[model samples]
Every structure is written in structure tokens, then in C-alpha cells.
Target: MASAPVIISAHLSIPDAELVERFVRASGAGGQNVNKVSTAVELRFDVAGSPSLPEPLRSRLLARRDRRMTGEGVLVIDAQRFRTQDRNRDDARERLAAFIQESLSVPKPRVATKPSYGAKLRRLDEKKGRAQIKRGRTTRNWE
Candidate 1:
């Protein structure tokens, strides 16, 4: 089973336990029910105070240009798409899980490679063919 997100080693890590934070009603739609119910969830994650992640990963996580990340290195993901609080809360948790998974992924290193000999020859041949076609289209002023 997939684990939930966890905080470790100044970085965020995926954990079996859920780490989704929630809040009550605040601003925005809901009408009269908004005042009575706490349907909004404020998912809070500390990217700089986790033990599961290494220093480098933590720094990278904090440096991400996500609008959800706060100035204090805390990530606040708000989920209110659903009318019910529980669904919204679950959605927020899923979002957190997805983000952590993405952060944990190691990118493939790019290896520099020179153009193949056949490819270079093909390009030259195409250029030569184009030149010949253009030359044939010109008027024979010399004649």
C-alpha cells in the first residue's frame, strides 16, 4: 500500500499515516451553511523540518516555485472543491501525497551526444538537393 506523507530530516517524506491539516469555515462561498460547517481544509506541510528527506532534497523542495508554499517554508494546500468537508479534506491529502511523490522522484541526467554520421550526411544531402532545385528555377540569363 502507498504510504502517506511524512516529515523527516528537514524534508517531507511519504508516510503511512495521513499528514493532512484541516481548518473550519473561513472566506468564500457556502452561504448560511458556511457559518455552520467547517468544510475547508488547510493542508500544512513543513518542508524544512522533516527527517525522512535529506538536506539537498529539503532545500530543493523549499526552493520550488509553488504558490502553495509560504514564506516560512510551510506549504499550505487548500481544498474546497467538494461541498462536504470530509471530501475536501481527502482531496487535500491526495494532493499532498502527489506532491511528495513528485518531489521524491529523481530526474534522469542528460547525457551529451554528437550527431550521428548518417544524420549529418542526410542533412548535407538535403541542403544540396535544395540548392539544385533553386538553381533549376532561375532563368538562363547566360544563354
Candidate 2:
């Protein structure tokens, strides 16, 4: 809704409708307030069910082993640090944005490299030194 959800990275995108979840008071702590108000934000993002997300991205998201992600591919982000519901809600949104941004980042391609001549020589030298040390420990025979 707000400028197509600020694209934090290349592959991440937050849709307007998906960000509508609200904050409620989390269970435990603030004995009275816990029972009275729902201040903890419980962000529920259906990664598997979201129609807007691309298939590859959806699969990648579901494959992640995040504690918040349920077996059914629903991500439940909880933000209860802040006392007010609005702050907690904002925090949850921020975290969700971060997750999406990280997920979208492209990893560097690995390049295969062979051992350098100098490195190989050093390794051989070390092996020779070990062999020489072992030889020195053997009993010497004098005729």
C-alpha cells in the first residue's frame, strides 16, 4: 500500500494485505494487563497460501527452519517487548521486513581453486620434517 512496500533487497517484497495482522497482549507477564488487553503483536503470514508471491520464493520461504514458521507454512512473528500495542505491531512488521529482505539477498557464487605451488611445497616440506624427526628417534647402530 505504501509505495509498494519498501523493497529492502532484490528478492523481497511485502504486499499490503499481508501486513494487516494486529498485535494482542501476549500470554504471561503483566498479570492484569495480560488478561485485559491484547498488546502482543502476532503477525501471521501464510507463505504457502499467499497468491502474490512467486513459486520459487514461496518454496524458499517454506524451506526455512525459522521457529515462527508453522508446518503449514504460516509465519507467526511475535513482538511483545514494547508495552503499547502499536509499537509491538510496528516491531513485528519491521522483523517481517528484515526476514523478507534477508531471504531475497543473492548469495555469492563459489569459485573452485587449486592449491598454489608454494602451498604444495610447504606441505611436502612439513611432511619431510615429520619423517626426519621420526628417523632421529630410532636407535642408531655404530659399527
**Highest TM-score, which number?**
2
Q: lDDT winner among the candidates?
A: 2
lDDT scores in order? 0.74, 0.77
Predicted candidate 2 versus true structure: per-residue lDDT over 1-143, tens digit per residue: 24246344565566767655765658767878878898988878888898767787777788888998998888888899877887887788788878866666456789999999999999999999999999999988876
Clashing pairs in 2: 23-41, 24-38, 24-39, 24-40, 25-38, 25-39, 25-40
Local error of candidate 2 at 116, Å?
2.1
Instruction: Give all candidate RMSDs, comma-separated.
Output: 6.0, 5.0
Question: Which runs of model 2 end up more than 4 angstroms from their true locations?
Answer: 1-13, 19-23, 27-31, 124-143
Error of 1 at 47 (Å): 0.4
